[model samples]
Target: MALVAFSAVIPLMTVVNYSVQDIFGPGQRYFIGVDWFREALRDPEVHGAFLRQLAFSGIVLAIEIPLGVAVALLLPKAGWKSSLAIVILALPLLIPFNVVGTIWQVYARPEIGFLGRVLNDIGIDFNYTGDAVSAWATIVLMDVWHWTPLVALLAFAGLRSIPDAYYQAARIDGAGRLAVFRFIELPKMKSVLTIAVLLRFMDSFMIYTEPFVVTGGGPGSATTFLSIRLVNMAVGQFDLGPAAAFSLMYFLVILLISYVFYTILQRASAS
Candidate 1:
């Protein structure tokens, strides 16, 4: 346990150290204190990106959780077909992230892309490159297409773990499908659902590559989330001090939210 902790603690300590000091050149450095953190907190763009990230995360959770549960409930409970379904469901997750972005980028183009052509033909006027609504829709739908499988897989595992005795008892009590799901399946799946929610929240909050590749954070700055904005500041503008500070703050936000999620779930389960 000490060895495991040492491995984790060493890296985190390095980030915290960098977050406070200014690296000017090679060995030329100065302790600038919390100036970077202060600046990051004051940046209007940072505030915008943070709020945008929160909204995106909320949208993802809202769509993915219920959709995943429904998909899991619809899936067969047993047999070779169920095994095949599991394999098929996992195929999308196995693909690389950048590749997923590129696939969607082309797929949503109004000219040569299948999705685009269909939408245009149907008079929907969809174009991710030019339209903010389309850009947002594409991002959300891409996320759903890429990630809903993860939720479904987790929820399916949760459903399968439930004892047959519980179902039998529900049947004997004259409970219908909805009651069995609400009182039995949902309660049993709470722990796994919590895990899924946290995982999705963290991933969505930190997402950069897909949106960056697909939209380049625009036709304008419509899709620039905190991570993308941080990268732009650090690499694009060469503002290392502020970038380091922003990165540390970013880590803390994720850590705090994850802690809150764990605490709430634990209390709910205990009660």
Candidate 2:
């Protein structure tokens, strides 16, 4: 608890302090109440970034969850093959985020990268650096490639934990593959899926490094999510006061949504 307070709570309080105060330098500060918060709430850039962040998170969850579940279902149940499958699936999750970004950066360059060269050769004007649609698609693709493995692994665990007796009963009752999955498998994986959604949503919402390295929050702020916007404000603009306020609101939004998800999961588990 003490360590947590020192590591987490102390920095948080410092942010809270900066949020309400206008500080130009050491010994150059003044309390401004909620002025910065009010301005941030009205800021168009913040609103745009918030919407983009939501869209990214939504797209990720949509792509990852079902795909992961399907892959998990298809993975071998028991064998040397199952072990090989698990190892292969876990490879992407093992790569560091910055490294993933750098890899995509090189892999999408039109002059040299295989993907870029192939697309241009096929007469598709695919340039993530110069085009908004391409940027969004590449970022989404990169994120999906890297993180879907985590969902697969989680769903794999949930799938593996189901007792064989359930499948036996389903078979005896003439339950088809679809029926078994819909009624038996899905219900059993609900808790695991809920956790997966929460984790993915939170991670995707706060994603910065990958997109930053890939696009530098561009093709004209098209890929600038909340985290990028916050960094731009805090570091680039050097507006600590407004940046702190934005950070606080960001934290609150995350906390509120997390609580809502937890409550829903609890209610679901109960009945």
Q: How many residue pairs clash in each candidate?
A: 0, 0
Q: Model 2, range 1-271, lDDT digits (tens) per residue? A: 9999999999999999999999888999999999999988898999999999999999999999999999999999999999999999999898999999999998988888888889899999999999999899889999999999899999999999999999999999999999999999999999899999999988998999999999999999999999999999999999888999999999999999999999989987999
- Give candidate 1's whole-model lDDT: 0.92
List the global CA lDDT of all models.
0.92, 0.94
Residue 83, candidate 2: how far off, in angstroms? 1.1
Best by TM-score: 2
Candidate with best lDDT: 2
Instruction: Report clash pairs, candidate 2.
Output: none
lDDT of 1 by residue, 1-271 (tens): 8887689887777777777888878798888899889998999989989998999999999999999999999999999989999999988899899999999999999999899889999999898899988998999999999999999999999999999999999999999999999999999999999999999999999999999989988768788899999999989998877888899889989999999999988987898
